[model samples]
Target: MRYFLPSKRLGFLLLALLLCGFALNFFMQAASLNMDAMSVFSWIGEYYWLYLAGGLFFFFLLLVFSMILPSVYAGSAVAAVLCIVLGIVDYKKLSTTGEPLFPWDLMLLKNAGEMSHITKGMIPPLALAAAVLLIAAVVWLLFKLPKIKVSLPLRMLFAALSVAMITGFVSMVAHQSSLAVSMKYQNIFWNQKVNYKQNGLLFAFAGNLRQSLIEEPEGYSRRAIEEIAAKYSKLPDPVPNVQATQQPNILFMMDEAFFDPTRLPGLSFSEDPLKFIHEEESATPSGFLLSPEFGGNTANIEFEALTGMSMYFLNDGSIPYQQKIVKMSSLPSIVSILKERGYRALALHPYDETFYNRNRVYPILGFDAFTSEKDLDNAGRITPEGYISDKAAVQEALRELKASSDPAFLHLVTMQNHFPFTKGHNGPNTISVEGTSPSYKDELETYTQNTKLTDEALAYLQQELLTLDRPTIAVFWGDHLPALSAGIYTDAGWDSEPRLKHETKLVMLANFNIGKEPLNTLSPAFLGPTVFRLSGQPMPPYYKLLGKVQDEMPGLSKQVLIGSNGALTAFTPEQQQLLDDYRMVEYDLLEGENYSQDLLF
Candidate 1:
């Protein structure tokens, strides 16, 4: 009759505690607009066992801890309750607006200004009641257990061990998918729905398990994984030869909200942002990049630029950063290639490394060093919009460049001009568009200001390199076009598909040495070969495979512009075959299929 034994009372008490934990966690999740059961359930089917284990373990751990360290348990319980209550308050605002929440959206809770004004103050009491009930259940079970049957030390040890095992298991799955379900099922709404359905427990449990392994269409993918790995395998060949000669220092820059200056109304510049970067520095450039995404996905650009793989090849609407369904090479592989050739490779982003899972993916890609917001000591200098100034990034680059003994390959991504164009937003760095064309003023202003800042930084950098004893190469290009507001889209006669037009862009750029020649234009897709040529590395078979086509019909070689022309239309057949071939090869490689026939081509 001991409560600690496998009795009905013990099971009921454990279930009560689990339900309370689930409700609290659910409310926290449902507080954001980007979250909901659907987003949470996306991972449930893939890792249900882990979720169940976490609940059981956490319950036992807390129980043991409460006995051993009552004060600590009291503080933790208070904090947990507060977090849940705050989440409830936030959810009240969004629920009113009919906006849903996602599991990984707790970051949005910190955005104080976006919170809804309505103060219904409804759910806190109910949440408190549930918490009280759980506490009561636990207390009742303790009292019911016979003191002689269960040793205090044994009870405590069992709880602690369960907690430790559960915590470790949950941590492993959180990165995979079970974290989503654990958060959602914690909510009363989702739990109620599962209970209402026939065989709801089995169905919900299976769904949760499915989520952990499945690819995240909106966040990350297996195809992207393989693509990244493949890009690394094809890293600029002739490593030793490239290292023998005094190779120029390489600088990779990604400018925010950048588009073809050729598309801009006024293109004159006293100081060119990327005038010197060119092919004679040994160049290979593509026509149209045909990026699979636009507006918000800077990760796709990173994936493409580093992996030399196209997002267009994967399932549409998949995000490669969040999920790891496929394994692929990354910029780090290029870093490794350079490392072999006595070069130092580094990744620089003027933002939080955690934003796009850069912290997780950067090392896998092969970079020796990563510099992010944490690396910047002066946090105040960073923009209010959660981004460090590109100028700061350049400063750090200069410092890092001076310290490195070997030729360096640096990846620098800038974020100054990211959309929402409003004057006075970024302090002294703001570009004034008051006198410019009123129609495109807001949109143009942000780009002009950000571009101007980037230009100034580059001009200073060029001068800095002049002081450097060794030769250097700086490659700079726009990540994507500016994100125009809805007003401009509507005003500019965009009725049917405004999102598509805004997405269209020119992504090719100058691949110049300190003072080298420049190509008239090229596509972003051609960058891999272009990098190989610039670095004096051997082109793999595929680069040559596409290189001949570019040579024969240079006009037809643009990466993304094949939709309009007759010859281009005819070439689609060949392109599709190439895509299929590449896809199968990529998949096979991910599946660990070893091939004697090199697929490097």
Candidate 2:
């Protein structure tokens, strides 16, 4: 035996395979809520065969990569490293934002500036241990693992076989409902957290693979959409606004990670952090916008506000910007409505234009001009985290508004108050928490001041609107709340349940009286029509239909629907009919053959 194979290569390979399999599980759990180690072990033990499937799936991927590369060692290392990096990124995301980074989320790596915060304190104990063991194996592979020479023909054949195997296995896992069912898989669209927990990381990812393939709504047909369009076109305007002297220069600001920190049960500050916005809320038509996303994922809310559509109707966690927006010829939006009325539609964001595929998506959405960080004169004025200040963002936005005398439809997505609420980022703490640990103070301090800066930014914007002498209405609201600590919401005695985590403040103020009908808590989808109505501009048939939806269901999302009475209620028969109508229009416009485009937009 010593003469034949002294190196014991078979034993080494087996050991390495076992280590890789176990690492995948660790990474999956780390990517989730750092799920308790004992619980994870118990689950693995209970479903050992299913866990084996995950390992084998990952092994197949490695085999494919190994065959493709010049050397098996190099290829396997590359594949393994990629998996570990993704695991770390997901771990960071779940740690801060309480959501695992999905496979589609890999597209976000191009905008690595926003991901820097994830690099800090991202590795947990399990990941660290896994890394230590994996590194040693990697070192052995580099130095000691012998490369067995095979013929070129044999190598090519193996590569092709490996590719075929991987394709077939993944396709089976993604498409076969029965296979997934047998292994206890499910589609928890409304709550991915629960989905991830129920099915471990690999299966959850495989589940998303199936979900990513867009599905046509039941009874979807061109004729059905056309009929739905015609019905809504005939309804009376749901949100008829007070007539303005002229169409108001609608200045919409979707502030990033903005919310009242004081709203936390035990939080307080030396003075009000959101003083200006607080005053504006009381004076103007203000309420909450039950956002479709929590922590972060601004594009979803942005999409809803621009186009009178809800994410509720689409697959969960689907980014229309990344997934669908660019594929369509044109989608009707507030920009489309305003542009037709001789307004120069501008989208200004104080961040990378490519961050959310905005550079590509904005033009298609009917923006005359899309300005981002690179285009701004004050792009360099950034916070410690490199997010552009709201001060600079507002200045650039005002400059643009003044430049174009045409009735302007300006939308600015500010970044000053974005996440990674690191301690001492603001130099000194302005906010205090009564029951929070000392560990939580730094993030709170940064978050509160960042919010305060947003208030100051609002003041600047409002003052500029007054000086313009144009009938201007501004809708300022948080894109979503900051992803603070994991148990922060629960620790505080606030009534913010998981569903309410999606709630963010909405304030619509103007240099003129925009409205006074108490535009209480509504979804962002309704904001477009609300603003259009405020400007006294007639909405297209699509918006008219949306206005009706708003009348019936003021706040709508897959998570919760706020009935007209301003409380969560099961859909009435009338409400269900309205929703069916809304869904047909949205699907027709976004994914379906645009049979209703002629009649709706």
Candidate 3:
């Protein structure tokens, strides 16, 4: 059947859209492939169908937007620049933090100074130049060329067709329709890094777009929340509150990317890199913390620690700061809990206030004050590479503590030991370990030196706390393991012994002797309750419930569920009940109605 013909032939416009579509796709994938032209070309050759999938989606988007202006070259040019820029930004993000760009990450753009900061990392000069010159020249040349005129009616028709086709394509990906199934597109929801590599970036992004629809726990209702709340309400206080003459000053100093380098499998240094930490751990209550996040997403670990909530139940690849907490009216956290008893809660981080929306979010979390990079007097007290050192963060916390008379819940987050681990960033590298990997020697040395400095800073904080006449308690821990540019962790057995990648030490030091003992490993969610119990603070029903769960499920997460025997084991029926109750309560607080916020928290 012949459709209605256009008044005049629309020549070369369709071809232009097709060429621009695939070209834009190549540049975008180049970033994810680490600007390796060889790898990008090889991937195109191997995953020909997947390449076409992303390209076709881009083509439809360009077609629809271009039709709005009804100019062929002009529309494609706008689309091309946006796509190329996205590629550059994604490249920088992956290289710097080991995290890829997601669809919802667009919300992070609201934070000022983010764009300039993201564009600053270790981007290769040739790749950046070639991407700019080649694509820019092509786009500029296209813009200068003669316009292929199509009537408004024909443009509208084309736009409608493009919308329908792309909508169908997206629907297929989201719903896993038969056609998409036939194409064998694996979403890889469990591992986002692999998802982007395996399914192509666009397909993986579309997969995440559907994650806004949160799943409800089985038989979720107000009744379920109340039932859980009732159980905790009847339960006895895990540790009764003491009639302390004075409330102790509590400091949670979370060091950036700090870990025991001596513990790494398949490699070692000449001596212990964290000598100070080792000595302190033997004297205090210290053990490993099973950090939910690995290389980056420090905010998530902070969320779990500050709030007695598990990231295990939340959506995969989701950042609570960006996705959940920022939107909520008030989140029940350690800060809020401590503030009820006249404790002054303050947050300290030597990075941008807007890095994780902490500037606005901290107030919502009930922080009395937040001191960030801009707020500091010596904000530039940093390494040569400009990452604010751990020393500066600890000093700021000490100053805040000294100034306040009320028991302060100071949440100190360090920014040293962050990426681009250039050799001698801190000072001379001491090979404290016995061996080394051939691939990541320079980075390993730089990272080792950084850890030594972190240990020293932490020791310094503890020594200062001891001098204070007032009773004081402090907990220091690592947020996550440092990620190297070589990306050799998986090869070096991070995957085989998954705990090694997630494992980080947790130490609790106090001026008063509260019977310190070593902990094998525990989840960040349990840290607040542990501190409360140790410090003789009044325990709320919600915290009491968490304490109970931790007794059974220590260091538990979606991936790592440790058994009583210290090995990964299947869930028992009793364990299943505990898990379900935990999920229901978390859902009630986070996503569902706050039915029992008062009753529980």
Candidate 4:
């Protein structure tokens, strides 16, 4: 007992072993969903030296802290507790969002109130009990250990060295050193889920932190902006001047977590929930929309749709509504153009107005009024779920359209079916799921039933619009797929194809008849131009350029772009130049001097 008690050599060795074990434990927790316990050995086999260095550095830092503390176990236990908490957080984040925790997410801790819906039932009771016991044991061991002491000057020197070592390690990783080549591939911005799965959560989080700052696009300058504007400044063919021509009222409804679950292979429901959607598709322009997001990130899809910008060009996990639109006088949005052409642009979202900073962002997007849940409640439009339903939202929109004599452009985002479809949320389960695990039946039923409600509301809105004296165009699309549990997709056998996973339904219906040509496929960025074209409104030069790109490539996303040849190929020089010009103009409108405002709006 005396030989090991308070001895620097023994204490340091034990601390080092503890740190290595803790790191391995964290890795196992982060990889639990995808990899077996034995996979830790494989990770160590690939990056043994890196893991060793990290363990040793952490051990050294803890040792230095122990010198200042009453007992070596106290410092080591503190480190253990912190690592355990981080591991738990990483596990929960991965389970919920299908991506590891990025450092940027920490800034959203204040929005914890809004996360209860998604985070419910994430951590099981047994895991919580085990964590409690583990923490208590660590505290007991910390107090039971003997105390150690060192001089003040030595402790300070040790602390400084530890900080320097950590700083050096972070710098090396940030610069993409050969030592971090394995991590480089995992830090890519295109797909965070794959990145988190390939690399462990800690490495992926560090990589994301290093790349959090937005990078300026190449050839971003006043001169370049001028040249691009001059080059592609040709206006789209104007609508013919005739007495029959009239500006159609436009309504865009972005439904939350609304997808066609029937697309899942080997999955069947008792009844077809999207019967109305099918009927509408048969009569109007409708097809699959290739969304930039999967499962979540609604604001990104909205950004792409409104401003004609692809999230592929931005940093991963970047929230333009929260980060980029700060203090901008004007942004490139279809709303701005509509407002300029004798239309009253209104933004309606029946949820927390401040969720995505939409209250401020809507004004910058050229909306005359921003109506949210508060306004909905004041206007006596509340649903049973406490969220305003699609029916209520459309009813309010109809009122606005009727009250205003001028043509109105309303962007309505519905929140009736926003996630955590657990049980009893959507009332009784009318739809039955087959070929899926019994566990997901309730969830699937809830989702399907809510979508049915949305479909009914859409059909009602269309009918009401048809009765109106003025012509109206209604565009409806799902923001992204629902964040269903992994078991649902895995058991349904639809987990292999990412393209299929990201596909969602889109439909454009009009009171006055339009061409029956199918929309085929398009990214959210091209929806604005599509809307303009369908309404017989002339598009700006930027939108015209996007129209030309759409002519060559119908669907463009980070993962794939379908070209005119109906084949997926790397971007040609022409496509790259076109995208570059688009990026420059987008940057100019959002972050630069608004150099292309004349060309855009």
Full-model lDDT for every candidate: 0.49, 0.75, 0.78, 0.73
| TM-score of candidate 1 against the unseen true structure | 0.54
User: Number of the top candidate by TM-score?
Assistant: 2
> Candidate 3: which stretches are off by over 4 Å?
1-10, 22-55, 64-71, 84-100, 110-121, 143-200, 240-243, 266-271, 427-434, 437-439
User: For each candidate, what TM-score against the reference?
Assistant: 0.54, 0.90, 0.86, 0.83
Writing each residue's lDDT as its tens digit, candidate 3 over 58-172 gives 8888888787775677776777778777777777667756667887678767763644553344666787798779877877787678756766677778889999988888888
Each model's backbone clash number: 55, 0, 9, 0
Candidate 1 versus truth, CA RMSD in Å, comes to 11.3
RMSD, one per candidate, in order:
11.3, 3.6, 4.1, 4.7
**Considering lDDT, which of the candidate structures 2 and 4 is the better prediction for this target?**
2
On residues 1-601, what C-alpha lDDT tens digit does candidate 1 reach at each position?
Answer: 2433544544454465556555444434334423466644544354445345534444554444443443433423544455555555445434332222223233334433322211112345687699789878756655665432234554566567756765564444434345535444331222223221211222232333323211222323445435534754554443321342566677777767665433333334333333432212233232333334445557767765665544544433234554442234433234555666787889988666775577767776778899986787773343465356667777788788878888888888877666445554455434344433476675455555566666666656656767765566566666655555444444445435422333333322322332233333333445555666655666655554334333332222212334332224345565554544444443443323324024453
Report the CA-based lDDT of candidate 4 relative to the real structure: 0.73
Kindly indicate the candidate among 1 and 3 with the higher TM-score: 3
Instruction: Write the number of the candidate with greater lDDT, choosing between 2 and 3.
Output: 3
Estimate, for each residue in 421-517, the C-alpha lDDT of model 2 and write its tens digit.
Answer: 7665534556565557787776777788788777887888888888886788889888877777766776775334644577787888778866555
Which lDDT tens digits does candidate 4 get at residues 364-400?
9899998887776554323354456778888988888
> What TM-score does candidate 3 reach?
0.86
Total clashes for model 3: 9
